[model samples]
Target chain A: EDQVTQSPEALRLQEGESSSLNCSYTVSGLRGLFWYRQDPGKGPEFLFTLYSAGEEKEKERLKATLTKKESFLHITAPKPEDSATYLCAVPFTSGTYKYIFGTGTRLKVLA
Target chain B: DVKVTQSSRYLVKRTGEKVFLECVQDMDHENMFWYRQDPGLGLRLIYFSYDVKMKEKGDIPEGYSVSREKKERFSLILESASTNQTSMYLCASTQVNQPQHFGDGTRLSIL
Candidate 1:
């Protein structure tokens, strides 16, 4: 069975303070991993996707790195607007594109 | 931009009432998914469809059903609304082995 777990359920950071969120998973064939940002009262917005170990992708103030068993979303000098729940997901290995998602890390960037 | 649109942003219903949540994607993607979001639990896939008239049960599919009468639209149905079923519902669409695009979500409350 594929499973995903995220740590530190929530985090509070001062503006411009950097931090990292973790997502660990157990699955077969490791199709792909994805990161998304979800704001309050809204659906998740796609962020990054990593397909192989040691792969990394970055967006403004956010960088995602993936290893064999885990993935990290690093926030660099985050701002108040960067506060949101970060979710990670992996595709089902049974030839379906269905995703199994993590509980997510709720980040609060205080100004 | 790929647009996934949910039928409602907020909905209220009573126990034993039948509820329908609709999602439409203009991108002509062949995959669509329905998920429910709750605190401390990540997106739990309720159902998904890969093509017209095709549907698959996801991680948590009890008390729910889905329809995919067309390639661009999917509908999730709650046979009988319950208080425990009150949560945010999200809709997503994508192509084969690709990242998904999400709608704004519908916050449903059952009384």
Candidate 2:
């Protein structure tokens, strides 16, 4: 079965701290991976999409990198406003549009 | 910007009552999706539509049905509301092979 797992269910970082969140997957064929940031009581906001190994995308202080079996979301100089739940997702199959999502990593950046 | 709008941010319904959650996307995207998010479970697909009057069952479509009368709108209906169905319902839309854009979400509570 296709599954996505995110490590470190929760994390606390000092302002400007740098860290990476892991998203490992087990699936037949890798099509694409997505990253999202969701604040409490709000919907998820799209972050990035990585399509292949060695592929990377960045926005502001966030960077997403993809590999054969996993993806990483690296945060640089994170501020308190950057605190949110980071979620990773992969398509359920190569042909389908459905997605399998991870449990997400709750990140809190302290000032 | 792609704007996905959900009808409500919070809702309350009694058990055995029918419930409906609505979503609309401003961008002329061909694909729209509905998902329920819960603690530890992440986002589980409920239903999706590729075009007007077309629908597809998702991973967790039981006890729920969907309607897509128009290209920009998609509705999710619960046959009979249950406590287990209380969750944060999110709606998203995307173009083919593109990352999905999400709404602000609707938090539904069953009593």
Docking class of 2: medium
Off by over 4 Å in 2: none
RMSD from true fold, candidate 2? 1.4
**How high is the DockQ of candidate 2?**
0.73
For candidate 1, lDDT tens digit of each residue in A1-111?
888999879999999999999999999988889899999999999999899999999988999999999999999999999999998888878777688888899999999
- Estimate the Cα RMSD of every predicted model relative to the unseen true structure: 1.4, 1.4
The 10-residue segment of model 1 chain A with minimum total lDDT is A92-101
Q: Candidate 2 on A1-111: residue-level lDDT in tens? A: 899999889999999999999999998878778999999999989899998899999999999999999999999999999999999887777677777789999999999
lDDT of 2 by residue, B1-111 (tens): 999999999999999999999999999999999999888788889998888998899989999999999899999999999999999999999876678899999999999
Model 1 alpha-carbon drift over 4 Å, by segment = none
lDDT of 2 at B70: 89
Q: What is the interface RMSD of each candidate, in Å?
A: 1.1, 1.3
